[model samples]
Target: MTQRTDVVVIGGGQAGLAAGYHLRRLGVEHVILDAQTTPGGAWQHTWDSLSLFSPARYSSLPGRLMPVQPGRTYPDAAHVVDYLADYEKRYGLPVQRGVRVCAVHRDGAFLRVRTDCGDWRARAVIGATGTWTRPFLPAVPGRREFTGRQLHTVQYRSPNEFAGQRVIVVGGGNSAAQIAADLAHARIDLTWVTRRTPRYLADDIDGRALFDAATARRRALDEGRADTGGVASLGDIVAVPPVRAARDAGLLNPKPMFSRLTAAGVEWADTTAAEVDAVIWCTGFRPALAPFAALHLRGSRGRVATDGTRAVDEPRLHLLGHGDWTGPASATLIGVGRPAREAARQIRDLLA
Candidate 1:
């Protein structure tokens, strides 16, 4: 028998969980379909030494607070997974694990979601799968000829795995910095490479003070008299300086963009050669929407196109944990609640 639901949320990570929680509160009948056997999504696959950059206070699902130990700066990936599991139990969110969605198509007024388990008929769908689904690996020449074990950061776990290997950590994001630092502490031979220098932020900041200054700068930019540069917001400005400091410490270095990969290892644009035993591509991810090709996605640069609060063109489909009012935080546990809540309200109104 084909099951029916008011909504079918794809992905069982923080964003999907948040959406499910909100829908449950509104008495909406929905089911969450996730590919992973667990609920934490990417966190379940993160490097073992990873920790949240945002504080616990900001890292909670809607209507639930992340349990915290006193004086703990931030929680580790394990703690985060535990929190998500608990949230699922508390809310009794109906999630089907190990159910990989294969395709989504419209059937008259209903949306048909086909998975490995079976087919579901839903009135609407929430694409909460997030932007971290597909890891973006640049196509460098001779990449296939590399004899080294090349893997994405998603597969990285602990430094113990790369104990004595010569590792080349690619990309300039937070993941690259953290992984390089962790490997270096383990006495592993590590080299960090990126196309451009990254911006890192302080662990703590005066929120109000920074907000005031940022507001002033935004106003100046809007007035057309001053240039705000390419910075999107305060977060971008705050993160730049500290990352440069890490670079100066020899922890991070900008390589002339990736050029080619040889059987011996990798060759950068400057003709420099690094014989790596393992290559860790810290490249970022994109949204996973392969199943919903029938919905006609409006994506640019591999991201779903939305008009601030709603998905473009597709009325029955909405995107959560995407860039709406927030930046990267929108995709994190700390920042997903607001967007999830907003999406729930819209869904409720649509069903009503």
Candidate 2:
């Protein structure tokens, strides 16, 4: 049997849930399809020690605030997972779990979302599948030739496995810093490498500050004002407690990116080489738009050209929570609400 919904939201993460909340508020009938068997979305798979850069109050969805964790300033991943599960239940959002959407294709006037369980025909589709599942590993020479164990940010968990082993952590972003901090005491030898010198935000700055700056920049751009650098002008890495402690202790030493990976380890342009046990690539992720491949909507940048959240070529499609391309700070828990609301409003109008 073919299921029919007014809107079909792909991925029941923070983004999908936000979209569902708004759609329901606007009286738009919709169903969210999630690949995970349970709630929490990407938060379920994050490292055990991962903590939000801000307090629970700053990291929340629309219509509800995340509860504060007892004795914790920044909520951990498990707390976030609990909040998401509770959020879904509280709102009675229509989310079908364990339904892996294969592709979305046009069926006359409606879009058919083909999944493993069944088919759903929707007037509009919201692509809220965040980049967690699609971890990116940069192509470095001799990567395949390296005999050392290799992994990406997604595969990383606690740092116990690397104990008494030499490890090289790659990337200049927050993940690299956090993971390096996690492994600081766990590993006997650790090397953190980045494309450039890692930039750290002021100790007092966190996600709330970043989100507000992004919003201001977004407003300026929308109002035809000069481009303020916004968050980009600030810094790359947030000086979270753990990161700050690690940096102060002189444990998080970042070196320039290696020239190539040898059979045993990484080699720099200076011909200096380091033998290591493993390499963790924190290079980040690309948008997970594989299901929309048939639409041919992505451009050379591997992004769907959009005016706000709506796709230019395919007006029926809205890309939500991917990144800034979808909306300013759209990928964060606090940031996704704005785009989700805008997407829902556009969807409501489209249906009308």
Candidate 3:
């Protein structure tokens, strides 16, 4: 079945929900197509011990503030899921769940969004599909030959299964730090590895500070002032409670990345080898853009070039929640609001 709408938001996550809220406020008729049957978005798949870098008051969507969790300083993944699910319901957003957008092609003046359930033709399309589904695993020699288990962040649930095992957690980002901390009490021989020395953010800094710094940097650039490097200049890892405890206990020390995977484990350039039973790659993810592949929008850097959230090659196409490329800190719950509002406003103009 082919349905028609003024706009079709191609995700129902935080980014999509934010865009839907703004579109609804602007009196734009739009439908949100979500691949998942639930409303939590990517937060639903996060590990059991994951916690937000910021407190509830600092992490929220455009119109709603996340409620504080009793006895907890920072909210966990479950709390975030609850908040997102409630946010969708609170706004009464028009979201059609269990619809997977397979491809999006131009159909004259409208964009044809082909999905598993049906097709939708809309004047504008907002690709808010986040990156959780597309976990990035680097190609290391002997990876396929490794006898032990290997998994990425998307597949990681809890450290219980890895208790008493020799595991290596790879990456230099927040996920690596948090997962390493999660495994600290699991009675496992854990090895934390990074491409470079891990840098810890100031204990007082959190997502709110990062977002404010990014905003200031953006404003400075807009005013042709000297560039004040924002979060990038600060550090990579956030000292969440778990990470802090693990660091204080000396369980979060990281070794340099291994040169290559070995049949039994991994080996470094110095000829040092370790027999790891499992490897949890906390490496990051790329944007999930399979539906937009038919549009041929990727530029030289393998990213869909955009001005703010609007795709530069396709005026009616907008990308959201991918990363700083889409908008500064847009992938964060609080940071996505501005870009979502801007995308909705542009779509409104385009439809008008």
Candidate 4:
């Protein structure tokens, strides 16, 4: 007999765990299926030296606080995993690890989720898989001809791996900056490539009253009325102090954007080419919703179409950990809790 649940949540990352916890609190019957052998999805795969830009106070999940040493800046990736493990144990959230959902289809009034382990039937599904599953690499010319060691930021672990090698980092995101800086300390000759100069911000911008003001500016921009001419980027709005400190330590300089990836490394738009021994693509990620292509997505830029908290096309499906849910707070760990709770309530009501 196929296992049945009122709700089936894909991916046991922060968002999925939070959704499961909220559902359990509401006395709803549900199951969480994750692809990994353990919890804390992307956190488990992060580089060894990675620490959240958000401080411990801001990284807590619902009903739990991320442990931290007093006066410490932020917890490392391992600490995050430990906290997630503890969260699961404390709440007794029903999660099935090592279960990768291959496909999801509508079966009568229910959804059928087929996993490597078994088939699951649910009245609703939450695509809490998060966005990090798919890494976005630009289709530059001659990329396949490059004979050098090429790796995406997802596979990157530490600078020690690239010691004594000339490395080229691509993209203008936080990961690109942090990886380039980390590699610089190892005395590796590194060059950063970006199409546009990435706007860098200090990591302490979360505390300022101006931070709230900037959020208002972001909302206006989202509505397409006003341009965020002088407003800071998301990186600038969230945490700027640590980023500034990294820059002061000579780790945050911008390079012209990527033009091509050649056998001799990367070529920039300015026609400057370097013979890099390795290339690290710190390019961003895309949502992993291809498994549910039947559901017509409604958002701009291929993101799931949702109005505030409700999904437009599929009422039974919801998204978490999306950028800027309720203002800027939606991007952080704390932000997902409210939305998770609201989604859980809606799921419960639908089942009733």
TM-score per candidate: 0.85, 0.99, 0.98, 0.88
Q: State candidate 3's TM-score.
A: 0.98
Candidate 1 lDDT at 216 equals 55
For residue 117, give model 3's deviation from the true position in Å. 1.0
As for TM-score, the candidate ahead, 1 or 3, is 3
lDDT of 2 at 207: 96
Clashes (backbone N, CA, C under 3 Å), per candidate, total 3, 0, 0, 13
Q: lDDT (0-100) at residue 288 of candidate 4?
A: 79
Q: Model 2, which residues run further than 4 Å from truth?
A: none
Model 3 lDDT per residue over 108-149, tens place:
999999998889999999999999989998998889989999
Question: Over the stretch 1-352, how does candidate 2's per-residue lDDT look in tens digits?
Answer: 7999899999999999999999999999999999999999999999988999999999999999999999999999999999999999999999999999999999999999999999999999999999998999888999999998999999999888888789999999999999999999564488999999999999999999999989989999999999888899999999989899999998889899999999999899999999988999999999999999989999998888999999999999999999988999999999999999999999999999
The Cα error of candidate 1 at residue 226, in Å, is 9.7
When sorted by lDDT, best at the front, the candidate numbers are 2, 3, 4, 1
- Ranked by TM-score, the better of candidates 1 and 4 is 4
Candidate 4 residue spans exceeding 4 A from truth: 207-246, 296-301, 325-331
The global Cα lDDT (0 to 1) of model 4 is: 0.75
